[model samples]
Structure formats: C-alpha cells, structure tokens
Target: MKQLRLSGSGGQGVITAAIIFAEAAMNEGKQVVQSQSYGPEARGGASKAEIVISDEKIYHPKIVSPDIVLSLTQKAADKYYKGLDQNNGLLVVDEDLVPNIPDFPNVVKVPVTRIAAEKVGKMLFTNIVALGVLVKLSQLISLESAKKAVEKRVPPHTIEQNMKALQLGYDAV
Candidate 1:
C-alpha cells in the first residue's frame, strides 16, 4: 500500500487535493481510503488529509506514518515532516514559505507557491501544482488520469485553467 498525507492551512485545498488523488487511484482500479481533519472555520486553521492506496483492499484509513508528506505551510511542515518515513519516501515542501528545512536525504524543496503565484496570478494554484509534482515524482498515477479527475472535481468554467496549472506544475519540476 502507498500511504500519503497532505497538510496546509484551511483554504489551501489540501483535503480536496487528497480526494482528487484518491479518485484518480480508484479510477485505475486501486483500493483507496481517504480521511480529513479540519476545524469549523474555513480560514486560518489547520487542515490535513490522508490517503491510502493499495492494489488489495485497505484495512485502515488512518495514516500511521506516511510514505510521502506534502506540506504547504511552515506549520504543516513542522507538524508532519518529522513523521514522514525517510528510508524510501519523500517530503515535498513549499520553499517560498519555508526557507531552511534541515537536510533530510529524501526531502525536496520546491518554490511551488511562488511559481503558482507568478504563473497563475495567485497562490491558489499551489495545491494543484504540488499535486502534479507528487504525481510525477512518485509515478503513482498518470497525468492524464489526474487531469480527468480534476475535471470531474472542479467547476466546468475553472477546469481549463486548473488543467493548465497542473501541467505547468508537472513541467516546472
């Protein structure tokens, strides 16, 4: 089974990104389980999501220690990066938000938020770009499947733009 966790502030789209990833995995005939934790407020609060994907049926939905951890904020990074399995896994972080992460052999620092803000005119695309990067690095799912899942999850009018954002992210790193 491949376990992953995504964490960021309340409005960074971490939970939604996890759902989209799980949906894409399910489309590929994998067994997937997803869970989320967040406060009642929609802004300035901690939010996290966990996803487990396996060829066989999954027994538990909770992520004990994620094989991969994606962090968009310093708070999220501080909370989850230490818990990531470094033996053969990765920690993807937003470099713009975090300047110095102690050298972890498996960690990758990407200026995702800055890249999105520069290319897309807002940092909202950070989550999608980060998702694309993870998909590329892990080869967990095809970009085509992820794009289709995003289309299904996003509003019709925003689909085209988000797809471009995903592609930009995939190509950026």
Candidate 2:
C-alpha cells in the first residue's frame, strides 16, 4: 500500500486534493481509502487529508505512517512532518509558505502556492497544483487519470486554468 498525507490551511483545499487523488486511484482500478480532519477553526485553520492506495484489499483505512507527506502551510509542516520517519518516507513542502524546514533526507521544497498564484492567476488552484505535484512525484497513478479526475471535480469554466496549473505542478519536480 502507498499512503499519502496532504496538509495545509483550511481554505487551501487539501480535502479536495485527497478526493481527486482517490478518484484518480480508483480510475486506475486501485483500492483506495481517503479521510480528513480540520484544525479547531471553521476556516483558515489547519487541515489534513490522507489517502491509502493498494493493489490488494485495504484492511486499515487510517494512515499510520505516510509514504508521502505534502505540507503546504507552516503549521502543517511543523505538525505532520515530525511523524515521518527520516528513513521511511518523503516530505514535500511549499517552500514559500512553510519555511524553516529542518534538514532531512527525501525532502522536496517547492514554491507551490506561489507558482499557482503567479502562473495560474489565482491561489484558488493550489489544490489542483498540489495534486499534480503529488501524482507526478509518487507516480502511484497515471497523470491522465489525475487530469480526468480534475476535469470531473473542478468547475467547467475553470477547467483550462486548472489543467495548466496541474501541468505546471507536474513539471515542478
């Protein structure tokens, strides 16, 4: 099984990213389990979403230790990155938002939100960008599946920009 954990602020759309990832995995005929949680606020709070994908049956729906951890906010990087064992998995963080990351192996620092706002013309597409980065880095699902999921999930009018954002993110790493 490949476990993925995505975390960021409430409005950053981590949950949506997880759903997109799950959908993509399902499109590829993989067994997937997805879940999420929010910080103590209704908005602008810390949030996290987890996905477990396996070729076989998934006995446990929860993520004990993730194979990939993507943190788009400082608080999320601080909270979630600690659980990742240095020798066990990879950590991907938004360098612009979550600065001051401790030195660790398998750590990738990308300016995700910055790229979205500047290149995509809106920070609103951060989740799709992040999802693209996730899929590209993990290679757990084909990029085509993720694009299909994005097309299905995002608003029809924004599909063009979202696909661009996804492509930019995929080429980021």
Candidate 3:
C-alpha cells in the first residue's frame, strides 16, 4: 500500500485534496481509504488528511508511517516530518512556507503557494497545485484521472482555473 498524508492549517484545502486524490486513485482501479482530522478552528488550526492506496483490500485506514507526506506549512512539517518512512519515503513541502526543512534523501521543496498566486491569480488554488505536484512526483494516479476528479469535486465555474493551476504545478516539477 502507498500511504500519504496531506497536512496544513485549516482552510488550506488539505482535506479536499485528500478526497480528490482518493477519487483519482479509485478511478484508476485502485482501492483507496481516506481519513482526516482537524482542530476546532475553521481557518488557522492544524488539519491533516491521510490516504492509503493499494491494488488489494485496505483493512486499515490510518497511516502509521506515510510513504509520502505533503506539508504546506512549517508547523505541519515540524509535526509530521518524523512520521515519514525513513528508508524510502518522499516528503514534499511548500518552500515558501517551510524554509527550514531537514536535509533528507527524498525531500522535494516547491514554491506551491507562490506559483498559485503568480500563475493562477489566486492563492485558493494552492491545494490543487500541490495535488498536481504530488501526482507528478508520485505517479500514483494518471493526470487524466486527477483532472476528472477535480472536475467532479470543484464547482463548475472554478474548474478552469483549478485545471490551469494543476497544469502549472505539474509542469513545475
């Protein structure tokens, strides 16, 4: 199974991203389990979404040591970085938000928020952009499946902008 954790502050869309990822994996004929946790605050409190994907049945939904962890803020990085699989895990962080990431073999730092603001004309697209980067880096789901999942999840009016953001992220790395 491939375990993934998407974490950031509330309203960052981490939960939505996890749902999109799980849908995309399911679209690709993979069994997926997604779960999330968040603080009471609606905006700035800690939030995390976990997903497990496999070709076989998923008996447990919780993630013990994630194969991949995407941290969008310094606090999330500090809290969850240690939970990544030490041997072959991939840790992706927003470079602007997390400036002091530990030196690790599979750490990828990308300016996700910057790119969303500069290229997509809004910071709201940051999560979609990050999702694209995750899809590109992990190759766990096809781009078409991810796009379809986005179309299904996002509002009709916002689909174009989100797709553009995803494409920008995919092209970035």
Question: Against the unseen true structure, what C-alpha lDDT does each candidate score?
Answer: 0.86, 0.90, 0.93
The TM-score that candidate 2 achieves is: 0.96
* Residue-wise C-alpha lDDT for candidate 2, range 45-122, written one tens digit per residue: 888999999999998888988899999988888888777878978899999998889566879988889989999999
Cα-based lDDT at residue 88, candidate 2: 75
Q: What is the lDDT of candidate 1?
A: 0.86
Which ten-residue region of model 2 has the weakest summed lDDT? 98-107
Estimated TM-score per prediction? 0.95, 0.96, 0.97
Better of 1 and 2 by TM-score: 2
lDDT by residue (tens digit), candidate 3, 58-109: 8977997899999999999988988877889889999999999966778999
Model 1 lDDT tens row, 1-173:
88999988899898888999999999999999999999999697999999999999888779987899988888888888888766886888888886667457788888888877898767887788888887887788999999999999988988877887788878876
Model 1 regions more than 4 Å off: none
RMSD for each model, in Å, please? 1.2, 1.1, 0.9
Per-residue error (Å), model 2, residue 69: 0.4
Sort all candidates by TM-score, best to worst. 3, 2, 1
Candidate 3 clash pair list: none
